[model samples]
Target: MKKISILVTAILALVFNACSTDDEFTFVAKPDPEGIAFMNTFLPSYILKPSNATNLAERFVWNEVDMDVQTTVRYELQASADESFQNMTVIESDIATTNQAVTVGELLALAEEAGLDTDPDTEASNSGTVYFQVRAYAGENPATTVEQFSEPVGITVELVEDTSGEVELPKIYVVGNFQGAGGYGSDWTPADGVPLAASGPAKTDYEGFVYLNVDKPQFKFLPTNASFDGDYGDAGETDGVFTGKLKQEGEKNAGTPDGTGGYYWFKVDTEKMTYSLTKVDWGLIGNATPTGWDSDTDLVYNPETKLWTLTLELTEQVAPDNGIKFRANDGWDINLGDTGADGTLEFGGDNIGVPESGNYTVTMDLSNPRDYTYTLVKN
Candidate 1:
């Protein structure tokens, strides 16, 4: 019995020693790391260059972080419109260097990508500040280290339009058998594609006309210079109007034209991400219409000036509200008239009054489809 008791005590002692042994390691959590500080406290003012600028504008610097261990650190420099960093845009990430320098071009792009603009440049509104901060993480794989972010620094940024004539945004062209010089399915060639007009500094508004023939059943829009990298096609409905927003390298759905195919105006507003296709056939229609609204006098298109021109004679006895109006397709569905008797025409507006009875040369300017204008001069 004594021997048995000794064996049990020895076993208990062995078990106690096993539990006390340092075989299993415990990770004592390190204190939260310290945030970095900007070596250059003030960031210089940034200006957007129309083209790529080579001069470095700002070089952000920060002190190294202490992770309580010898490990390589990865730094992520971030820029944001808000101080809270809710919608943070990382300028640089996974960088071993703590300092980051950006060029004038780079800074401008970042600001614009963040929905910042320079238009209506004013002291109170167009100008503002952007927040810059740094986040440091330790270790290479699994990123196993304490992470800390520096206090945000404010950088005054001035938003301005790039009028240097050196910048041109990506443009979309009408391709795929749009009744141009090439016949049909000519998506691979740039010469055959109809170029769309770009507007605004952002070039988000695209407008142009394409002469489509009835033989071709469909057409699509190419987002590049016939490179065909990103093209947007019919958005599943397969109708003449593709309401779906253009996506890069998206599905190729063709659009069907209406009215046996004619000159169709396409307006693409990237700001709104919407497109409209309208068939335009200008005609003089009203009580002054040559055939009393029964027949229409067509206006020829001038390719050089992008205006509709027509010369006709009118009598002293005015009929339709003492004037006439321009209608598309000889119908009232899309008609334009002068509201203030000014050169500009308002859609579905009042009749443009004639000053006197004479042969007049009327020119309607549709170069900028968003704003239509017309001029009537006595020949």
Candidate 2:
């Protein structure tokens, strides 16, 4: 019995040594954060042009990820519209090389995710930011592999699309008594009114947002930001939400949509000489947000900055194109979305998304006329 037990122990020892020093034993890789970083000099900002879409935007080079052992590794380049990596796009796909050439078109696509538009006709803001990072893994596939991510870098993207053949958009100004303390230089002066932008040079429709503190506040619109040569004002005695017509000459100032003013959406049609004002209170809703799609998470308005802000935890949606929207009065009648996935807002557009789940500060800035933009800052 002692001899048989000794034989079994010897056999077990031999089996352990056989698998220990070979492929049978998987190597555990340790990540080195200090040695991993971008080796390229990142530009402060890039002005992307559609005309140069096929050109090289940049060659992303990075230091080799130190795994503390000799082994093959996979490299993945990630680009995102938000700092939080909320909705990241893996460039091309996972690769083994330390560097990859990104084309102008690819960068432009990332800029679209950031909501930067060079087109003057679009209502979205023209400047935004994109973030990049490198992910290193030990195996061909990411599953069960030792993986780590490099520190992310942010780049500002300003779009300068080819506007050679396009018509230049027109400009209008709004000067109101509500602005009297001079957020726009002594409110009642058309020359000093807030800029109200037109959709296009051919389209005289102008839109903007404004806040009023006093009851019965009045205002007027000027065709130019610097002159009152042609201005339009109220044609009725009482405040008109939509029924009142605009008169170019010999008219009283346009009164508030309601006697009690808070915030309003302003619109004017130069051809029709018609103006409308709708009081709006903005809210955020979607599956990605805590409120889900059925209800709204109301955003607080900061009168000083004229921005709507909300801080909340957001969930990552792995499914494509499922995200969030900004609506007014907790309803879909007036909701804003980013159809182009650009940082700009359309009345009813595509869903906005995030890639990683985290706490974020969501801001909706409609203070600038026609150029509505929003920001999602991860905390």
Could you say which candidate leads in lDDT?
2
Off by over 4 Å in 1: 1-81, 85-125, 130-156, 161-176, 182-208, 217-245, 257-260, 271-274, 291-296, 300-307, 316-322, 339-342, 368-371
List model 2 lDDT by residue over 310-363, tens digit each. Answer: 999999864336888899988899999887777998898878887789999999
Candidate 2's C-alpha runs over 4 A off are 1-168, 237-243, 318-320
Residue lDDT tens for model 1, 245-322: 553334554564342566677877544556677878998865554565576789997654557899998544442366
Quote the lDDT for 347 in model 2. Answer: 90
Candidate 1, residue 302: the lDDT equals: 61
lDDT of each: 0.58, 0.69
